[model samples]
Target: MIWKELKKQWRFMDGVVIASLVVLSFVPLVVFSMNHKENSAKEGNIAIISIDGEEVDRFVLNEETKHKEKTYYPGKDKYNIVEMEGTKIRVKEDNSPDQIAVRTSWISKPGQTSICLPHKLVIEIVSGKSSDEKEEDDDMIITY
Candidate 1:
């Protein structure tokens, strides 16, 4: 009896609705899939250090780079020591009281940043980008 009642109400529109729903569920799969470009041999990762919103130093990050340390003076008697080695960069030491940037160590990927707000300094990592392309993506929001 239940089967007979269901057959009486079901129509062509019901099949259409079910089919459309199935198709709509797959739309996200096609829409959200992204193609990632492999890093080019000619281009390598770079780290940029800035003081008071101006770039002060830039370094190519890779295993070939020598282990080095550079100190930046952002204000009177205030300094930040940045270290780079083997494709990784970090704030080795700083005069800031909280020592937050110093504690966050070894950033080695695109979009990673180490900021010393008190000293008005920033270090940002960029991957496979030219100068112009880097400027455009400065405001990009990277989500997990």
Candidate 2:
């Protein structure tokens, strides 16, 4: 019959088509799982800024409204303005060429960071806990 003839002609590609569809279905699940893990691990609201490998400033992101610092590095006079509204911190202004740091969006989590390579500056969000408290918490988690 015509059906049998058609099946015989397409048999070789049937498995390949089905396998590709199955793999494509799992891609969205994997992407959403990774995004969930990153969001769940968010832990802090303190912003720490470092320039040239030295700690330059620290601000409680929720307490401060705004802060601006001008930096002189060798031949450049660069600057950054940090603004915090409620619990979020973001780079409101930056003098870097590409302005990547200023465009990085707002952050309020422990591991979040914004960096400007041309100016050698890095801003990181850190947990509010003291080192001793953090060490004890880590030990407890391991024991559990």
Best by TM-score: 1
Model 1: how far residue 46 lies from native, Å:
1.0
Per-candidate total of colliding backbone pairs: 0, 0
Question: For each candidate, C-alpha RMSD in Å?
Answer: 8.5, 7.4
Give a tens-digit lDDT track for model 2, residues 1-144. 999998878876798999999999999999987864454344335678888888878876544445544433423576777666755777788778999888997887778998878887788988766678667857543343
Cα-based TM-score, every candidate: 0.63, 0.57
lDDT string, candidate 1, 24-126, tens digits: 9998776544321235233667899999999999999866889999988899999999999878899999999999899988898778999999998899988
Give Cα distance to truth, residue 61, candidate 2, Å.
Answer: 2.5
Provide the overall lDDT of each model, using Cα atoms, as 2-decimal numbers.
Answer: 0.85, 0.72
Query: Candidate 2 — worst ten consecutive residues by lDDT sum?
Result: 66-75
**lDDT (C-alpha) at residue 29 in model 1:** 75
The regions of model 1 sitting more than 4 angstroms off are 1-42, 131-144
